[model samples]
Target: MRLLVTGANGQLGHAIDAALEAKDAPAAYVDCVVDWVDLPDLDISSASAVDAWFVAHEPYDVVVNCAAFTNVDGCEADFAAAFSANALGPMNLARACATGDAALVHVSTDYVFPGTEPGERLETDVPAPISAYGRSKLAGEGLALAANHRTHVVRTAWLYGEGKNFVRTMLRIGEGRDEVTVVDDQLGNPTSAADLAHEILRIALTDDYGVWHCTNEGICSWADLAEAAYEIAGVNCRVRRCSSADWKRMNPQSADRPAFSALKNGHLESTIGNQMRPWREALEDYLR
Candidate 1:
């Protein structure tokens, strides 16, 4: 199988690379020729550039699109860049895949839903995005599924691993500060990029295609996650909990986020018998 992975330098992309490199998981990626591409080499937002690359490469069995414009506040300010990367980019790849009869695994986010309810969201749940970033991603999801027959949308939340994410930020801040303030009202899973990557690969291995929610099992507030990180790191720091409103009020530039965006991994577990580890367990392993 010939596999093409975009956003090769991102957290999830790096985790996929690590998974492919593991000798113990030879069967996972065996007989697969993978090509990793990003920015300078391939601009997914440009249809012409994307088409040219597809033509040059000829055929690909699978295209895992991890590339996205993830800046929520930035998206509010610059809708063009956000729509180009998050929405149009996936459409280009999906169209290309449709032409080549290839499967598409598009990475999405739980932000697509307006998080007002307290329960975990299912794949069947209606999406009512509130922010520009969420709308862009929702648009991408629709286009991807509609453009390609073999498209799969994987929605995840609260991701961190070996990159600029919450866990790393907390660890870094703990080094210099005696206390950290985090939002206690906003709730979601703290998924490790590695775990999400592994799950993506497993999905790629199958021909079944649809929307799937993949994240570390348990859910918690940002404050809980920060406290867990400090505890695991053995950092002597106090984590002060504040409401999401307070957090945003304190940081005027902070983007609007879902208050309860926890996703239920129903389809993935039902279809593949694969469920992610709990958030705390994944965090412990990641910190170690």
Candidate 2:
């Protein structure tokens, strides 16, 4: 099946690109190769550009939309840009899919839940996003979920990979500095973008058609994940735990963050049987 992966330069999309050709990857994910398209070639934020590309490409079996406006603080500062990239981008892609009779697997986030309480966020749980970024992403999910009626939204969290994540950030701080500080109050699973990409492929192929939550099996605060990172990387650093309020005080946020927003993957497991590896294991593999 021909597949198109958006945001091919991003960690998750690039991982998916590599996994399609990896011999060690699961048989189901190995053979199906994808055509990776980066920003200018297929930027979903530009409807005309995306529509033109769709007209040219004709039909794609799966369009895995990994593209997102992911800067939480930036999103709050610039809601228009966030909505354009996060919400309208998916909407445009979903429209393209409808035009070409294609399927879509839109990746979403766990931030859609309002962090009013502490617990697991089930697939059936009603979303009450607390931040501009989260609200924009939730809008993206809603558009993609409703656009084609055949699309699936895979909500995930705490993504880390080769670069540009909390894990890597902690690794850098631990290696470069004597000590580091991370917020302990916020908790969620550390999802590997590579695993998430493969899971996206699984959902795209299967008959499961709706919003489903997927993430690594365990939970951890930023402090916990950072500590695990330092331990796995064998880097020595004193990690001090602090509250979200303190974190915000140090690094003022444009958006309100969810204190605890772990995704539950029971639906995806039952339907596709491609649950991601444990966060610890994935983190170890990533660090190595």
Candidate 3:
């Protein structure tokens, strides 16, 4: 099976590559070739270029799009660039997948939800993105679904692991700051990229096609997440409880952020099954 992975340099993409390189992991990838395409090698923003590459290389089994314009604030600052990469990129790939008869695994975010105070956002929740980044991702979801290709979209959030993420950011800040303040009100699950990669493999290996949510079990606020990071990293920094407004004061948030955007996994729980451990467990393992 020939698989093409976009955004090869990202945290999720890098985790997939790491699993492929592991000796004890699934050998299906041994016979299966994973084409890791980064920028310059492949740019999702160019439709013609994407079409040409797909036609030339012809990904046999699937195209895993791990690429996206992830910076929330940056997206608000430059909506065009965000749409070009997030929305148009998936649009082009979905079209290619449709033409080539290949399955697609598209990564989405919890930000697509309104993040209002409520129960965990079910898969059926209406998407009301608050930020430009969320809007772009929602657009990608629309394009992928509209393409009508045999595709899967996995929505996750608060991701970390071997990459610059919230946890890492907290640990880094703790290195100097005696006290750190994080958002205490906003709630979301902290997903590890490694676990998300494994979940992606579960979907890919089974060829199950649909939208799924694969976040780490349980939920917490940014302040809670920061405290955990400090405890795990053996850092003795005081993490004060604060609101989003506090953090956004200096590092002004680019896009509107979800206040409560936890994703429930009724589908993944019943269908392909979930191997993702609790957020705390995944966090500990990632730190190790």
Task: Estimate the lDDT of model 3.
Answer: 0.85
Q: Which is superior by TM-score, 1 or 3?
A: 1
Which pairs clash in the backbone of model 3? 73-254
- Model 2: per-residue Cα lDDT over 223-247, one tens digit each: 9998898888899898999898887
The lDDT of model 1 is 0.91
lDDT of 1 by residue, 93-152 (tens): 999999999999999999999999989999999999988999999999999999998999
Q: What is the TM-score of each candidate against the true structure?
A: 0.97, 0.95, 0.95
Segments of candidate 2 deviating more than 4 angstroms: 24-33
The numbered model that scores best in TM-score is 1
Q: Ranking by lDDT, best first?
A: 1, 3, 2
- Superposed by TM-score, candidate 3 places the C-alpha of residue 288 at a distance from the truth, in angstroms, of 1.1
lDDT of 2 at 267: 86
- Candidate 1: pairs in clash: none
Candidate achieving higher lDDT, 2 or 3: 3
